[model samples]
Target: MAVNKLVYYIIPLIVLGLIAWWQFGFGGLFENLKGGVKGVIEMAPNVSIGAEEELATEPTIPREHEEAINNLVETIEKMVTSPKKNCFLNYKLLGKNYGTNSGMPSLGEGGTTISFQLKGDKTEMLIAGGAGGKQEVTRLRKEIAGFKPCVIAGSNEITKNFFNRYLGQGQILGDNYKPVSIINIFYDTDGDNGNAIRVPEFGNEPVNDEGDNFEDEGWLFKAEDGSICFFPTNKVMSADDDGLVYGNINQINTKVGVVGSGLDYCYTWTE
Candidate 1:
């Protein structure tokens, strides 16, 4: 019995030693384990951070500019809240960039009119004209509902390209291009005055030979009676129109329905 037990124990010990030697032979098993660990580490997500990360940030409007916009908003609120008669805000007229003979067929003018009217419970903004004297853009008030004049600051690629093309090489348009100041103001107490809106900075300057005078950022606000208005920096001058935008009245008005209603509250230059 004792001999049989010793044989059994010796056989088990020899089997255990052979298994250990096979597992650790020439360090190959350990190398395989190390490679598996390395692969797992390589598959892990990276958590390191640096300055190369990209972020989206909105440009900031200056404090004074903010104040100006607030004041303008307040003025608009007052005008729209209490309806008036024989009131209009006029802006220089504009036409399409289409070749000659591309405006009103009868008057040879392309204009727009933007009106603020009280409809039901909400104030409605209505536009009534477009290229060729047709109301092609806006047919319903909701298309332009809640459309209030706003100010936009900050230099962008479009602004840069415009300046580069007009200001010429080495003439850089800085990031500080702000359109905050009031260009003109009209009060509708009188019914005979036609407002002349000067483009705050660029309007007063005559256009150059390269068809770049004052760059109009386009219509800041267009109305339904074929009237249009510009942002303070935008101007209306064309090489084809003899430098005068004719038949274009930048009119912002209540629906007095009068042909020549004067401005009740016109824009006045702040700075």
Candidate 2:
């Protein structure tokens, strides 16, 4: 009888011990395991830390304008640098035009016209006029021929070759070379009494015979109609030959109004 009683007592104690282990001891073990897993996660790569910073403010231009500008820049870059497309040329106009009654001067008040006299590896007469008089228009057409299509390439080798031929060698019409003319126009839209823009200086002195002048400087063209334009004077050669012109367009700041409306923009090219 005593033996039976002792066995019963020992079995109950063992059961109690197992239950305690399953409840408290096992729970503690699982918690330790979970903590170890969390530590591993903390030690893992901080992928988010290497991400680029987000912009503090979003872009102001409409998506369409942004896209159009981007396309224009890309096209210009390809024309400048593409070995195949080296024969092509590009131009751009900046600023906006508001109605006369809107308190903004007409396009005539601005030098909104551009002309070119190109002669080189390829011969062609080409002309593009701004919003002003037919004199600028007619003269521009008489001076140049129709534009030729050039191949567009993305490789640096192709771009280098195009730059060498078009810009470096001046081969647009064989050997005879002429100066490239760039015209800019600016307009004041707000009618702010003292709002006037000074032409930025540009030139290549003692370097090339092209009679480099203020127009040669990379400038932002703002039309009296409030159109903002940018010409890649500094990077024109490279931009035309390379396929990466869009990158430069993104660098422009359009907040500086010419007249007022920022929606006015235009561009063209000659070669």
Model number with the top TM-score: 1
Candidate 2, 114-213: lDDT as tens digits: 2222244222323222333222323223322222212222234543443344234433322111122232223233322211222222232111111111
Q: For candidate 2, what is the total of clashing residue pairs?
A: 46
TM of each candidate vs. truth: 0.24, 0.20
State the lDDT of candidate 1 residue by residue for 35-154, as single tens digits.
676555446523222321111111232332233333334444433333342133322223333231111111112233333443333444443333333342232333223333322212
Q: Give the Cα error of residue 92 in candidate 1, in Å.
A: 17
Give the Å error, residue 75, model 1. 2.6
Angstrom error at residue 32, model 2: 41
Mark the regions of model 1 whose C-alpha exceeds 4 Å error after superposition. 1-58, 85-145, 148-262, 266-271
